[model samples]
Target: MKTVILIGAQGHMGQAAMTGLKKHNVITASRSGTGCDHTVDITSKASIKALFEKVGPFDAVVNTVGYCEYANFSEMTDEQWDTTIQSKMVGQINLVNVGLNYINNGGSFTLISGILNVKPIPMAIADATTSGAIDTFVQCVAHELPRQIRINVVNPTVLEEAWDVYGEMMPGFQPVPGALVGKAFERSVDGFITGKVIFVDA
Candidate 1:
């Protein structure tokens, strides 16, 4: 059984991912540290490094958390933009950068990205931009990783489980089941494909 590190374990998406990964030895982590095995602040590289160091060797890392600010394009502030870039784009990237040291050879890294990048909506410019950036980052970095390590990003649309919170903003977009999204991550962790964006849109 592969030892997996699952970040953002307390969130809805994280819980969805946990469904499919239940068979594995999954280590749950989150920023709040409530109801999870550990706490980690993805925005801080030092926190990420510390988490990995404490966990020791692991076979895979699945990150289901990244925050982006939502605001009208015209009203968006510099701080909002910075928050999106730092948390969604750079923070996820840092996971790969720092995790290389502790992950076992051939281990995989699975990151979360939303469908906003391809399917745009109002007031989500920052989120869309960062989502696109994450997809691109995974596609490019997959070629450079050593020791047969693999990486992929899961770009799922609004989940059925989260529709109540995000449905109105998404308009006609269909909400997919969390189980389907979880399977995508399972594929990335157990399969050989790398540098791919596994989309789970119903």
Candidate 2:
């Protein structure tokens, strides 16, 4: 089985991914610097570098971390924009860049985006922008990555477990189970396709 490094291993998506990736040798990480096998703050390049160093080589990297602000586009503050750009956009890419040397040849990188990029809501400016950026980034980077390292993103809809709080906010669209979304990440890690956005529709 392939060795996988899973960042953000304690979140909702991360826990779901862990279940799907159970067959593989999965290493879990969190930013709390406790409980998990490793700690990483994706927003900091230095922190990312250290995590990889401690962890060593791997066959795939799966990231289920990131957050975006929800607010009126007009009133969105600079801090909100920065938080999304720095953590969601830049942080995910940094994992690929800093992880190049640590991954085995033909290994894959699976980043998480959300369906918000396609079915945007009223206050999803930050989420939409960052999700869209990650899609473009993977498409662009896939062409130039050395060592045959693959990269892709999983765009999942609102999760079933989280529907209680978000159900009223998101109408019309059904919430997908996290396990169903985990299949997309499995495809990215185990399949040969790269630069594709695997959608988890509900």
Candidate 3:
């Protein structure tokens, strides 16, 4: 079976991917080291390099971590902006940069984004910006990556269960189940497409 790494292994999406990707050799990683075989600090190049060194070789890498700040562009704090840049954009980008040396040829990389990338919302500039960045990165890298390795991003609408917390902000959006989002991740990791943003719409 092909080997895959599920970053942020303890999150809901990560857990769901664990189930969906059970057929592969799945290795889980979390910053806090929860529900994972390894602990990875994606922001640190040394941490990522050490992780792949220990795991030997993987066929794919699925990143399910990263969060963005919510505030008006003017009111957004430097801390919030910096956090999103470091955690959401730069961190994942760094993963792709460093992970190039570890995964096997023809392997794939899967990333997560939300509907906010396309659907604009107040105070969601950070999220939407980062999500769009991810998609762009995947598209550009797909054409440049050596060895046929592919990359894709999944952009899901508001999840059904997450409605309880965010329904007011995302009006009119039909919610989707977490399992469906999981399936999208599975497709990105195992499918043949590259540089595509698979929408998991409701």
Candidate 4:
């Protein structure tokens, strides 16, 4: 089985992904390092670099977390925008930027992006924009990556498990099972396709 590093391992989505990746050797990570194999702050390149260095070697990487702020466009503060960009956009990108040095050849990267970019909701401009950016980034980077390294983004709608918390915000949108979303990550990690956005909406 491939050795895979799964970020945000404590979150609901991360737990969901773990189900599908059960066959692999999964290394867990989170910002707090609580119950995780290592700690990482995706916003900092140094932190990401250090995690990879500490882990030694891995065959795949799956990122299941990013923070985004919700606010009306008119009321959105500069700090809010900066936080979203740093954590959701630049932070995830940095994983790929820094991970290249340590990841095993032919290994894959699976990133998380939400469905907000395509079906947006009020007060989610920043979140939607970052999700779109990540999708586009993955598509563009797929062509440039060396050593057969592949990349894909999973664009899932609100998860059924998270619906109790996020349901109100989604309104008419349907929530998908976390298991289905996890399978999308499985596809990216185990399949040959790259630069694809696997949507998990039900």
Candidate 5:
């Protein structure tokens, strides 16, 4: 059985991934819940390092943590930008740096992006910018890692869970299920996908 460490393993998508990956030797890392075996703050490399220490080596590491704010670029605060960027972009880079040290050869690293980078909507400036940055990083960094380790990003559209808040605003746009996105994660890790951003809209 391949060992997999999942960050942000308590959120909606994370929970769905956990359910989908039940057959694997899965370990959960996050801020809360007894459901998660490890605790991590993605913005802090020290915390991430500590978790890897406890988990030891693994076949794959999946990061699904990132905070996003919906606001116009002119209205976005420096704090909001920093929070999302650190949580999504820089934090994912940190995961690669840390995970590379412990992953076995042919292991994979999967990070989450969102479709806003390609299909932008109003009030998504912070999210779109970070999403684009992550995809670029994956494409470039795939050649830099050792042991044939691969890196990929999954860009998902709005989830069905967001309907109450964001559905009406997006006329005719379909909301994909978080469970379906879990399958994208499976493909990125188990399939031969590297330096690519898999879009999860259907």
Candidate 6:
């Protein structure tokens, strides 16, 4: 059986992926760590290192953690921006750097980005920039990963469940189902594509 490691498995998209890829042995890491097989802080290299030690080797590693600030650029605080960058941008990088060794040769890596990278929503500067950075990083690093390991990213638009929270705010913006987002992850792991940014809105 293929072994897959997931970060932020307690979150909406993570849980959905867990259900979608039931055939694989899943190792989940998160802050709360509830429902996950293990716990790791995406922000810390040591934590990620410890996590890999416990899980042993994996066929693929998927990251579904990241946060973004939502507000007019002028209203965005330094703290808010840092929170977004640290968790989304730096966390993903850290995961790859520390977790890559745990993946078997020719394995795959899937990272989560957002539609903001291309859509450029109002008051979403940090998100857009971080998302773009992630895509670029994947492209640059894909050439460096050894033994045919592939790297890809999934960029999903607003989720269907998110509508309830911000439905009134986004009048015309349609939300995609969480299950659909999960499918994108499945495709990234199961397919042979590499250095591609898979975008899903419909």
lDDT of 5: 0.86
| Model 6, position 177: C-alpha lDDT score | 84
What's the lDDT for candidate 3?
0.86
Clashes of 3: 0
Which scores higher on TM-score, 4 or 5? Answer: 4
TM-score of 4: 0.99
Candidate 1 is scored at a TM of: 0.99
Candidate 2 least-lDDT 10 residues: 14-23
Q: What lDDT does model 2 reach?
A: 0.90
By TM-score, is 5 or 6 better? Answer: 5
lDDT of all the models against the reference?
A: 0.95, 0.90, 0.86, 0.94, 0.86, 0.84
lDDT of 2 at 95: 92
What lDDT tens digits, residue by residue, belong to model 5 across residues 84-181? 98888899899999888888999999998888899888888899999999999999998898888999998888778767777876677799887888
* Model 6 misplaced regions, further than 4 Å: none
What's the TM-score of each model vs. the native? Answer: 0.99, 0.96, 0.94, 0.99, 0.93, 0.93
Between candidates 2 and 4, the one scoring higher on lDDT is: 4
Stretch of 10 with least lDDT, candidate 4: 11-20
Q: Estimate the Cα RMSD of every predicted model relative to the unseen true structure.
A: 0.6, 1.1, 1.4, 0.6, 1.6, 1.5
Over 4 Å off, model 4 = none
Cα deviation at 170, candidate 5, in Å, is 3.5
The per-candidate count of clashes, in order, stands at 0, 0, 0, 0, 0, 0
Per-residue lDDT tens digits of candidate 6, residues 1-202? 6798988898876866666567788778887788778888887788889988998879999888887778889999999899889978998988888767778988888998888778776778998889999999998998888888999998988778667775665566778888888888888888899999988886
